[model samples]
Target chain A: MRPIPPWPRLRRGLEHDYTILTVREDIVADPRTGQEHPRVRIDCGDWVNVIAVTREDQLVLIRQYRFGISAVTLEVPGGIVDPGEDPALAAARELEEETGYVAGRVVALGSVHPNPALQGNRCHSYLALDCVKAHEGHPDAGEDIRVELHPREAIPRLILEGSITHSLVVVAFYLEHLRATAPR
Target chain B: MRPIPPWPRLRRGLEHDYTILTVREDIVADPRTGQEHPRVRIDCGDWVNVIAVTREDQLVLIRQYRFGISAVTLEVPGGIVDPGEDPALAAARELEEETGYVAGRVVALGSVHPNPALQGNRCHSYLALDCVKAHEGHPDAGEDIRVELHPREAIPRLILEGSITHSLVVVAFYLEHLRATAPR
Candidate 1:
């Protein structure tokens, strides 16, 4: 691997605040050219995606209308991690809040930048196994979410067939699948 | 699933422009509350991710410093899809430009929203098999990228062990792996 060059940030400022997302502009000195260039960065808070698996080996999923794409997308239960909240706790909270499921065990899958090229936030993924419906789902006021459960074996098929299209959600399931199938 | 609600956009305007990304604000009527809300949208062009595989069964990967995170990341060959350029063509072009590898076959794996909650662009993923290095890589003026190749078999381990942590890149490889193992 090549050494990481110094990308010096000359200045940064919040350009716009839209509650959920803040747009920031940064002037950085490009390592390759030694010239300053302005770049836009979206500062969305850290998010959590939970692959909650039921005792029956089913995956707790959600179908919701994404306003950006204006389409109902099937994805794993997840949401933004509230300020100062632990990612694992956020995962558990989102799973229960979005699907009414409680996980017996919450394990970290991994975290990744949703889009390193532009967005400045980490999306932490988790595997919540042995989930059970403990209460009625209580989605946020703006969220019209439908909870669904599917056999865990059907996830790959769903992804391949284009049913699950959220990149971070797909990654959460992929990590869970890898851990489940790894040779001991 | 509930019928898709009408998310009527009342107004939209560019909030800021920073070369690579343009920030736009949209006033839309919230479906659940019937109240207008201001949302920031990052207007990045559609991007492409390529899983370029050599005849020797190696995956072409790149190491680059991401300015937003200020960390070196190991990701598959990819870049922004030029305006009016086909995603497949952009995938092939990015592979060649970033790694000097040309694929014999370029197949669409899938497309996903980088951040459905905010970003308004799709990232098209592709599988480029039987790739061969035909020329030297030509990274852009600001990009200092290093190309590397790894055995295809090591991809799952790399992903599971957290070597490859870019969400979109992981999704691209996951789709490829699923397609390769699916029932014919």
Candidate 2:
């Protein structure tokens, strides 16, 4: 017989000072045995990712400093969604801020949780189309964000060589594929 | 006028260690403006995410405690990849470890640098199909992972509502879409 799914009960867990990442203790009902078992949990800050495509139809990607991952990443332009801000607007703002590029049309690509197991926040990804050069990007204090553009078709080959290996960028590329082929 | 792109630099800046998150830094060149920036980088453990399906063609998913957010999360079956392991092999191991159901086949969906800027390591996602019930799942010492299966069409809807929000999961879904439509 198939085991019944777990039912969570956080009867007790610890909290940490850093708000972005946290861990907890909890329980779940095992599907095979139908019993509760102890487990640890983790959470991370919510973030936003944007797919900024220029007028020539090239993807506008940025290599920005991520405090979590120290390496400057060559990725789609985006940032954290401030409290009470709509994600769509956040996407547009991030695109402009990171690339000095604005969208003539903005499309909601979709949203995804970076790591649901440990983080509570959602990272909504947006696709900005018909983009035009807005201004030169100005990263935050001490930030050194550089921008680049890649032809749409070159992404798959890049993935094979692991050049465009940033997880979010890969997601953005796959989303681009879905948008092209998905039936409305 | 458009800003000229900075030449991509593969250089290191100042480095340090932070106890707060047990992170090591490898300050890299901020490609945006060509400045020396002290970026905080860390080597996070590797991770695995799966795109598993049942005999009925429903997508396999799981929900468990996320200590960071102090909430329950519905997510894809996944785990940390042991050091020196191929991501595709790790993904298959996670599917069976968390779900107890064995798949007839496992394919590399794709890989993503979930958080490249600061964190080290990669997240390998995979597609597992033609599954059958195995023995009870064997979770880690403190894990209480629960498994569930959802219809294929339901995925996109869940994504919008923030239910199915894991970044790796979202990417895996889109990859599945691409494989489904590409010319065979």
Give the winner by DockQ: 1
Runs in model 1 lying further than 4 Å from the true structure: B1-4
Candidate 2 C-alpha lDDT tens digits along A64-95 = 55555444556788777877888888888888
Candidate 1 residue pairs in clash (backbone atoms < 3 Å): none
lDDT of 1 by residue, B1-184 (tens): 4575757788986667767777777887777778887766767799999999899998899998786676888999999999999999999999999888899999998888877767768889999989999987887777778888898888888887878888999989888878879998
Fnat for every candidate: 0.59, 0.59
lDDT of 2 by residue, B1-184 (tens): 2443433335443333221123333344545555665544445567878888889998888877664454667788888777788777788888888889888888876666777755666777788889777977887755666788789888766765568656777767766665565455
TM-score of 1: 0.94
Residue lDDT tens for model 1, A4-60: 786888998666777788777888888767898776677778999999989999888
Question: Candidate 2 chain A: worst 10 consecutive residues by lDDT?
Answer: A1-10
**TM-score of candidate 2 against the unseen true structure:** 0.74
DockQ of candidate 2 is 0.36
TM-score per model over all chains: 0.94, 0.74
A59 in model 1: Cα distance from truth in Å? 1.9
